[model samples]
Target chain A: MAAVNFDKVVKSFGAFTAVHGLDLAIDEGEFVSLLGPSGCGKTTTLRMLAGLEFPTSGEISIGDRVVNDLAPGERDIAMVFQSYALYPHMTVAQNIAYPLKKRGVPKSERGAMVQKTAELLQLTELLSRKPRQLSGGQQQRVALGRALVRDPKVFLLDEPLSNLDAKLRGYMRVELVELHRRLGRTMVYVTHDQLEAMTMSDRIAVMEGGRLQQFAPPTEVYRAPANRFVAGFIGTPAMNLIDGEIRQSGGTWQFHAPGLTLDCPPLLDSARPGPACLGIRPEGVVFGSGPIEGVVQVVEQTGHENIVVARIGADMRLTGRVGAERVWQAGETVRCGIDIDRAHIFAAGAAGERLNRPGLRPVEAPAVIKAAR
Target chain B: MIRRVAFNLFAWGIVLAVAFPLFWMLVTSVKPQFELFRRPPTFLPETWTLEHYIRLIQDTPFLTYFKNSIILSTATTLVVVAISTLGAYSLVRFKYRGRESLAFLVLFTYLLPSVVLIIPLYLMLVSMGLSNTIFSLVIAYTTFALPYALWLLRSFMAGIPEDLESAALVDGASRMGAFVDVILPQLLPGIISTALFTFILSWNEYLYALVLVNSDSARPLTTGVMNMLVSSFNIEWSLLMAASVMMSVPLIIVFAFLQSYLTRGFGAGGVKG
Candidate 1:
């Protein structure tokens, strides 16, 4: 119902800084995910917005009012913790009605609201049971029901589905997206799982070392990551990164490494060619026959697709995805074609900013190059 | 099978060894005065008599002593549990300097023996003009019970996740509301166990009761029963046994009522379950 904004928020515990100069603005009814690896300050950022943690400096606001000094109760936010922190003594109905009761809602109205919320969560049959009597998924639903029944201005979920089984996680992911659609409340979800952030978030904020790395849509993050960390962290088998130098070969500029060489994209024509990192997605490394030849080190079948890890030389290893029908074996000499137009190029050192290429728009094209005979 | 049998035998031996004193007290309370003085002690009385019980009720102020013990123990348990709960909550939830050392200091107090401090405590009470009063016994009992009560409840409070209370706070409840609505309920088993422990400690306490109170009207059952042996030249063994049995009945009932909670794992299903 309200936009949440963090303006240069920094959090530290004693001498250790957990979040550093964070600035983010979540629009009304937006489902934004704060995604990062563990200890990356994603949860700390969410807790600061929830008023559970006070920022060491800077301001956080929900709607137009700055909430830096407000208590969590005064912020009118509901949070579903990763542990599904349900009151063990209260039954499912009572758990759902707790927020309403705390707000001093009358008995009859609270009862009606509890019934409605439980029915929405498909927990009507389990209302009489305590949290201990319910299944893991049921306990999760009850936690969700408790947060939802209050109908707060913003919903904060900290890896809520991480406790469930794999199958249940998948089910809950869809259900959560659907719930967000129905409610259309500003929700800030914190998770380390990239798939969850990719599948559910309208915009994902990828973080590293207590700082925001990239904030963009899922496709933009996948097709055009802002930095090397986002490039490596956002994908499944992860993007293959090769450290090499760009040098003038014959007349055109070419990237050269241990056992690889490819024409540099025209985007680098203006810069003095030095050291750069080449990033290629698994799908971008087509594995039929092309310029790059390597021995397949390992092949893993994931039912839907095959992931082939190939070593091109003494030092470089690249993974490529192929159709399930194309059987690959270890030690097999396989040639792969790198999608040069779709590949990402970054500076060699720590702050690896992406180098923009003129011909490459953030659009999917089957620009498959054939092997040289 | 042989090892299992040996283990069972060893366990039953310990149980019998512990139960023998209570068994002897019950049987001796019902024995007639002549049987109590018999050379070969009777495990089972030849003739059970109600004369000792009748004498205890009619001759002595045994009822008044029993009533005073109940009031003192109940008051001590209530005060100890309330003070310890708040103290334990502050110790567990807040992050201040010396928090760990403060908890350590409370545990250190429990290590000090009551007999070591009884003389100074008695002198202080006399100077304060609090001697021979039931209120003095209550105050002494609470001081003895508080350290252990705080230590027990502090550990129990530590097992409860802070997330439960944080969730409550975000659900529109104030800090105190979260403590009362979320934490207090989960602490039920721990509180029950602490109350039972303090109650039993106060009830069976003889040292403090002996030093703090002397008047029959203010004396607890423990000291009052000891006074009986001194009042008569010939010790009435049957009457003493009857009084001992009566004093232990309330303790047995309280233990039986709260035994399950006392031994249960607090916060079992609060998090993952």
Candidate 2:
């Protein structure tokens, strides 16, 4: 296994830039995911690492060897495409043995290696069948088998599980984690799905608009996002970002929006009292009794919880996860409470920097109001 | 139910109308020379005789012309298909300056009538001293066949997903190695269909064959069969029909072998990926 490093890499297509000044270092045998939305540079970064696309400027090294001019085959890397890209004309056995054959492995050894890989992927039974004859999950396994037989220094996967159904996607997600564990190889996974990145990565690199927004462990990325984009992009039902301004009042800070005001935690010395945004996770927005009141607009039932989208004022809307046992109807005025310690404050814009520090998360609330169970 | 029946009947009527001449050619080949001017033409020969077919094979230079046609068509098909397959692959996959205009130019050449090219092609062949040879016809045929074959195969090449080649490249195959292993197999059906078209085109080509070669040794069946009817004053209809039947046998065999791929090739060759 090898450690992969990108040093200030930038990829541009003539006038348009895809990735800009990306510097990421993945440790040996670590599962690092490049996560972002579509048109974000996640796929481009993975392709450059795979040697399918060369970087416009910067150095990429696999285990101390810079591979700037190497062709994909010369890079000693294998990739599993999102479409699986199994050779339609070749059977499962041939598909798995393709890399071995390409590398001039002898006939006898290729058979054994292919058989071993097929067994590892549980594809031995389907070895004689063509790619079109197999189901989507089976094809995915064969694609993985093709990559595994090579036993390259690093495995690059570009949304390999995106093609499968939801249940199969989940199952394959666990299978991929197990595979990575068994092999103990460096793997760089590129995915737009935040759940895939959060659940399987050793470290997640959150990217947007061709720039690295944050690269940290999954929990850290979730608990302390680097910017307002990461705060809004990483979570389900999305983090509620209320645009407001913070002002110093009576030695503490108060955040004010259109029809809402809340006491902020003790600010850091660098904290400026200016235009700032408040970010709270859906779980942090309690639906019982607190300082602010809001009318419920829509309740989305997801079996285990009710996701309530409530209008706090004429403009601000908050989404809160509440118990499914208590049904919430539209136009009902409910008291809302923001978890002050857990809530994040950011400078107010799309690419705003996170203002709240993790060290300041333990401050007590201004009031003793409790949320209903 | 009645409307469906009428539709079926109409479709069968059209099929039969198209197939009538082929049926008549077969029937006419087996009939005796005396039955040629019968008051009403016989749908089936009353006295079936293989005399016309036997005489045409034994007493004429039909075999020589058949051999020439086979050589010309096969050579044209091999050379044109080989060049066009690579050309279409490059046109569809590679990014280069003038790539779009180059593809458009190929179709532009195809749009030009073959008749317009004959005189200039004949002059060039004569100056090169390539006139009256099978190789010359192959070259002449390529002038028309290459563009047509390339245009057909371009769409077929585009229909193949680019990801498959990327997968192969990452799997340690060189670009050409990936092409031989991944692309050739996917393009086999398309190549077969294009070959079939080019072969049929060169085989049935009359104008170039008539103008370029006068020797019986280099004559293809289309013009050679006409020579058999014109060289004689009597104009033996049975002999002409017999030669026509023999000319279609190779195509019929080729169609039988490639029927499944032919339909698929046509359907996919029109749709761009």
Candidate 3:
């Protein structure tokens, strides 16, 4: 296993730049994920690490050897594509044994190695079957087997589970984690699915517009997003970001939106409060009683929880998660509470960098606020 | 029920209309010489004769011409498929400057009629001392077959997901290795169809063969069969029909083996999900 380092790497395709000058370093044997939406350059970054793409500038090193000029084959990496990309014409054994065959391994050795890999992936019975005959999940296993049989220094998986059905995708995600633990190789996974990145990576590198927005553990990223983009992008039902102005109301800082006003989180008082964006996680939007009031516009029951989307004004909407037992109907007035300690405040500017409250450590925010100051 | 019957009848009508000429040729090839000039043509010959077939094999240099056609077609197919496969793969995979224009130029050559190119090609061949040689025909056939072959193979190669090759590259295969081990296997059906296409093209091509070759040893079946009308007074219709049937046999066999791929191959390579 090898550590990967990217130093100010930039990738451009003619007039369009896919990846800006980006610096990232992954520790040896760590599973890191480059997570972003489409066209956000996450795949481009992974491709550069694999040596499939040459960076326009800067350096990349794998275990202290600069690999900027190396061919993808020379980089000692294996990749699992989103499509599985199993060879349609080859049997599972041949597919798994391809890298060994290419490296001029003896036929007997290649056969034995392939058998071992197939058994590891529970594909021994499928050794003779072509990829088309296998189911989607089976094909995925074979793709993994092909990569595993090589035992490359790093494993690059580009949305490998995206093609599987939802249930199978979850099953494979856990399997992948087990596989990573068993092998203990450096793995750089690229995915647009936040949940996948959250559950899979040792460190999640959230990116936007070819720039790194945040690189931290998933819990840290979830708890304290770096900017408004991360705040909106990382959560399910997404974080509710309401645009408003912070004003002094009877000595307490209050956030005022179109039809709702509430005491601002203590964090806002430290900053030069003007126009700011308030980010509250769906789970942080407490129901029952609070200063802010809204009429429930929709309540979607998702078995474990009901996602309650309430309209505060003509255009402003806030979604909150409540237990499935709490019944809410459209047009019912409900008082909502914002968990101030859990909420994120971003400066109302183009960058929208997160603003921290005074006297609170960066990593530790209080669980509950007595009242918003 | 009536609509279905009408549809079936219409389809059968088109099939028969297409197959009738082939059926007529087969029957006409076996007809006796006495029935050749009958005022009203007979659907079935009164008596079948093998005299024309016998004459074609024994009297004429038919075997030599057949050998020449096979050699030329096989050589042309090999050369065209090789050049086009590489060209198509490069066009689809690489991001080099002028690639789009180069692809456009290849298809542009295909658009130019071979008839318009015949004079210049013949003169060039003559200057190179290749006139009246089978090599000249092979070159001419390759030139005409290359563009469409490249076009078809490019689309087919493009249909193959790029991620497959990327996976191979990251799996410790070189670009060329990935191509050979990964891309080439997937392109087999397309390659077979292209080979058949080029083979039939050169086999049936008459204009270039007629202009470039004069010897019986170099002449293909298409031009060789025309030699039967030596004089209008002695027009060997039965011999011509027999030779025509023999020439089509190879094509029919090829199509029969590859009919499914042939129909699908045309529509296969253009779109990818």
Candidate 4:
């Protein structure tokens, strides 16, 4: 098992940059995710690591060796693509044994390995069946099994669960987390889904527009987002972001969003009275309580959970999650307050460049990050 | 439903029309000579005899021509498959300068009419001391078969999703390894059809064989069977029919073996979107 390092690695397709100077040091045996939206260069980054695509600039090293020009086979990494990409013509046994065979392993050892791996993945019964014969989840397992047979130094998976049904995806997610824990191999997973990143990664590298926006522990990144993008990108109902000037009102600060206002938390209150964006997760938006009121415009009941969308101002709408058993109708005005202590404030222009809480010295009282001017 | 039925009938009608000559050849081979010339053209004989079949064995160099055709066609097909699969793989999978130009060149080679080139080829063959030789015939046959094989197999190779091969590469196989292990097995239908196509093209080729081979040693069945009518002067209709029937047997057997793949291989369900 080896740690993979990307030192200012950059990839460009002609004039358009796909991955711009991405620097990451993935620890050995760590489960890390390169999470982003589509076209945000997550797959491109993974491909570069796998040696499928060479970076346009900088170096990529697997462990101690700089293998920027090495072939994919020389990299000792296995990737399971978004599509399972199982060989349609081969049986599950043949597909899983492909890499071992390619490596010129002895026939006896290879067969034994295939059998052992199949049994491990619960694929023994389906060994003779082709990929098309298997369900999507089973095919995905086979794809993983195929990679696992290689016993590569690093495991690279590009949204392997993205194609499965939600229920199956969740089940597979749990299985994967267990597998990662069991194997303890250096694994770099790429996905657009933040839940997958949050639940699976030892560390999450949030990205946008070919740039690494934030790379930190899941809880660290979620609770203390590096930017507004990470703050909005992570949470379920999304973080409610109201950007306006922090006007001094009655010697206390209030975040002003046109007719809307939020009492500043102590951490935010002490920060310079400047233009800021208040970040509150939908769960952090307390409803039926504070000064702000809105008519319920729409209610989406997702079994066991629901989203209550309320029209706060002439055009502004805020969404809050409630239990499916809780009944709330449209056109009824409801009061909602900000969960003040949980509210995060960021400088107006630097809302996308978050303040690092790790560097801030803790205080006996609540502390705020004085972001670089 | 009405349109589908009409289409099926029309398709079967065309198939039957194309197959009539071989069916007629088989029927006439078993009939007496007098019945062959009879009016209304009896497709089946009132009395069948093995007389022609017996005669064909003793008559001419039919066996020699059969052996020649087999050697030339099989060699040509094998060579065509090897060359075309490689050419098609490179043309379909790799990106390089002159890729389009190289593809156009292959198509141009494929489209080069044998009739237009046969005379010049014969002249070159004679100058090179290759006339009336089985080796020259195999070369000519490969020239004719390679282009279509290349073009068809290129499309088939391209139909395999790149993701499958890419995943294999990441799984520790090289690109070529991925192709041989993962992609080539999926191309079974294409390879089978291409082999059959080259074999049939070489087996049935006539103009070049007739033009280049004056000796009976190099003559194939097509030229051999047609010659039986003229060189003997007293036409043995039954023997000629027997020879004609014999000429078709390999094709029939090959088609039978490859018919399923041939149907599937004919451009349907190609790499679904």
Best by DockQ: 1
Ranking by DockQ: 1, 3, 2, 4
What ordering of candidates by lDDT runs from best to worst?
A: 2, 1, 3, 4
True contacts kept of each: 0.74, 0.67, 0.63, 0.65
Model 3: per-residue Cα lDDT over A125-147, one tens digit each: 99999887788889889989999
Error (Å) of candidate 2 at residue B195 is: 0.9
Assess every candidate by TM-score: 0.94, 0.94, 0.92, 0.86
lDDT of 4 by residue, A25-98 (tens): 99999999999889999999999998889999999999999999998888888889887788887789998998
Instruction: Sort every candidate by TM-score, greatest first.
Output: 2, 1, 3, 4
- Residue A185 accuracy (lDDT) in model 1: 96
Tell me which residue pairs clash in candidate 1: none
**lDDT of the candidates, in the order given:** 0.88, 0.88, 0.86, 0.82
For candidate 3, lDDT tens digit of each residue in B46-149? Answer: 99898989999999888788889899999999999999999999999999999999999989999998899999999999999999999999999999999999
Residues A1-373, model 1: lDDT tens digits: 3999999999999889999999998999999999998999999999999999999999999999899999998998999999889998888999999989988999989988999998899999999999998899999999999999978999999999888888899899999999999999999999988888888999999998999998898788888888788888878788899999777766777787887888866554544578988888888898978988899999988777888999988888999878899899999998888988778877777558776563365567422211111
Show model 2 residue runs off by greater than 4 Å.
A249-251, A266-273, A362-373, B261-273
lDDT by residue for model 2 over A83-174, one digit each (tens)?
Answer: 88888878899999899988899999999999999898899899999887788888889889999997899999999988788889889989
What are the root-mean-square deviations of the candidates from the true structure over C-alphas?
A: 3.8, 3.9, 4.1, 5.3
TM-score of 1: 0.94
Question: What is candidate 4's fraction of native contacts?
Answer: 0.65
What is the TM-score of candidate 4? Answer: 0.86
Identify the runs in model 1 with alpha carbons over 4 angstroms from their true place: A246-254, A266-274, A349-351, A357-359, A365-373, B126-129, B230-233, B263-268, B271-273
